[model samples]
Target: MVNRHRGETALMVSGETLPMRLTLGALAELEHAFAVDSLPALGERFVEGRLSARDIIRIIAAGLRGAGRAIRDEDVAELSFDGGLNGVIKAAIALLEATFGEDDASRPPQPPA
Candidate 1:
């Protein structure tokens, strides 16, 4: 079962459903991949909305790994999804939204300081 509360989303490939998430570690990996200094920088980079084919692969791959699936970018590149490239793009965007969301309001409530 997919759990949005924990940032879990599903990716469909070859008629199979795979669970995906952008956990803390996965987000860190993305920061490194994008050569950003901090989480906010990474968010800025993504918000720019300029992504390549490889970028999409890296995202889906990391999301798979975040959900405990040992997968590689090469393998992800080979998979055929339902909506094809568009499907993968949608999944990636959804994953990003699930992680960072639209704005500060979308962020999780912070505890009392």
Candidate 2:
């Protein structure tokens, strides 16, 4: 359930807010990992809707393994769903906001004549 309001998509988990720093870190880490593993092609396949959630998890696991990271079976299980994806995206946004301060609206918009 993607909710778009006020020009921002709401990516919350269980109605709980995540800290910006953590979220950003997670997003950055995921992106960095993907790049390091040269899995953009796989990601493109996923984006094209050719990959299932399990396929994505498998790709991620393989990437992790290639990077000398140990991925437990449970970890793969945990990431195979919409909830996990939402959590990751939300966390990334929070992290980005933390790295760069929140946006400010100091000036009022002019009314249409």
Candidate 3:
């Protein structure tokens, strides 16, 4: 299960439900993987929704690695997806959104000093 409010998502990889989140290091890795010159550029690229199999694998691998999981691109490529391609796509989107989605706006205002 994914807790959107907490930026925690569970992905089925290698027949296991692995927790994933993106750290600053993971985001930087993604920028480098996509050959983007800036973080905004990376975000824009994903917004365009154009990616190859290798790209998906890399992105998911980064998320796994960020969560302290020892996974590689090759391992990611071999993982079985019960939900097929759609599941992979969903997991990728969930991972990205969980990491970079809008800030929570429902919290109560801070008390005055």
Candidate 4:
């Protein structure tokens, strides 16, 4: 009974493990989708000062489709490490911000009389 208890404890300590390869695949797909679709929109929003950091992250995750199951907060946290999905998302956001200065606000606003 002691050995069984120890085994169970070990399993519990290990926690839920995500497969490394699967995670990598998901990250790659997310990166690709962001590059193709969401990045431009995010950039536009940033230029307009309408995109927050959290909003950028959420948009990137939402842009990922048919990659796998929905990415959870835990996955986002895990991906924030070096060479991870979070890094990719941040990079994309930075690129957009740099490329498009906050000039959208200069445009004439729509009248709502």
Candidate 5:
């Protein structure tokens, strides 16, 4: 389940429920890894939904750290996903949503004139 308020998304990892999200520190790490000028660039790069395997590892690593798990990309790559590739993809989506938010659902409410 995704917790918008807490910026956390729960995922079953090797029979354990792990919470994933992107903290400021995690985001910075990603920015450095990707060599992007800003967070928006990072977001924009994935806006089209195309991600390389390395991208997935980076995102997952950052997410694990955000959830207070001190893990590296190598560790993430070595883990087994119960949901398989699709499950990993779902977790990635959850992480992205938790980080950048779910587009329309995240937009601030418009005030009535």
Candidate 6:
């Protein structure tokens, strides 16, 4: 069960739906992982959209931990996703949106006049 208002997302992995959140501790861990000094800086890094495959793994792993799961990046890599790579990426994106809320950049571009 996910509570979007509380910044919660769900991950479909190994035939199960796992709840994920970016709790303060989890966000701090991400900050350290990215070598960023502040939460905003971490957010900025994501905004840059220059993430590697490893970065995706780390983000999802942290989200799992945030939801109180004893999961690791390596463990996450081993799990099979419901919708494959696309699903995995969606889960990470959802976690980020839950934490930071969606912005204009995430929305579809409007047609030019």
The best candidate by lDDT is 6
State the lDDT at 108 in candidate 6. Answer: 90
Give the alpha carbon lDDT tens digit for every residue of 1-113 in model 6: 98876788999988899999999999999999999999889999998888788999999999999899999899988989999999998898888877886655578988999
- Higher-TM-score candidate of 4 and 5: 5
Off-target runs (Cα >4 Å) in candidate 1 are: 102-113
TM-score of each model, in listed order: 0.87, 0.30, 0.81, 0.29, 0.84, 0.87
Model 1 TM-score, 2 decimals: 0.87
For candidate 1, give the lDDT.
0.89
Evaluate all candidate structures by whole-model CA lDDT and list the values in order: 0.89, 0.40, 0.81, 0.38, 0.83, 0.89
Instruction: Return the clash pairs for model 5, or none.
Output: none
Sort every candidate by lDDT, greatest first: 6, 1, 5, 3, 2, 4
Question: How many pairs of residues collide in each model?
Answer: 0, 3, 0, 0, 0, 0
The list of candidate 6 runs beyond 4 A from truth reads 102-113
Maximum-TM-score candidate:
1
True-structure RMSD, every candidate: 6.3, 10.4, 6.7, 17.3, 5.2, 3.7
Per-residue alpha-carbon lDDT of candidate 1 for residues 1-113, written as tens digits (9 for 90 to 100): 67878888889999898989998899888988889989889888889999999999999999999999999889999999878999999999889888878555566989999
Candidates in descending TM-score order: 1, 6, 5, 3, 2, 4
For model 1 the local lDDT of residue 20 reads: 96
- lDDT per residue, candidate 5, 1-112, as tens digits? 5565778877667988788889899899999998998989989876879988889889888988888888889999988886988888888888797677666565899899
Sliding window of 10 residues with minimal summed lDDT for model 5: 97-106
lDDT of 5: 0.83
Worst 10 residues of 1 by lDDT: 98-107
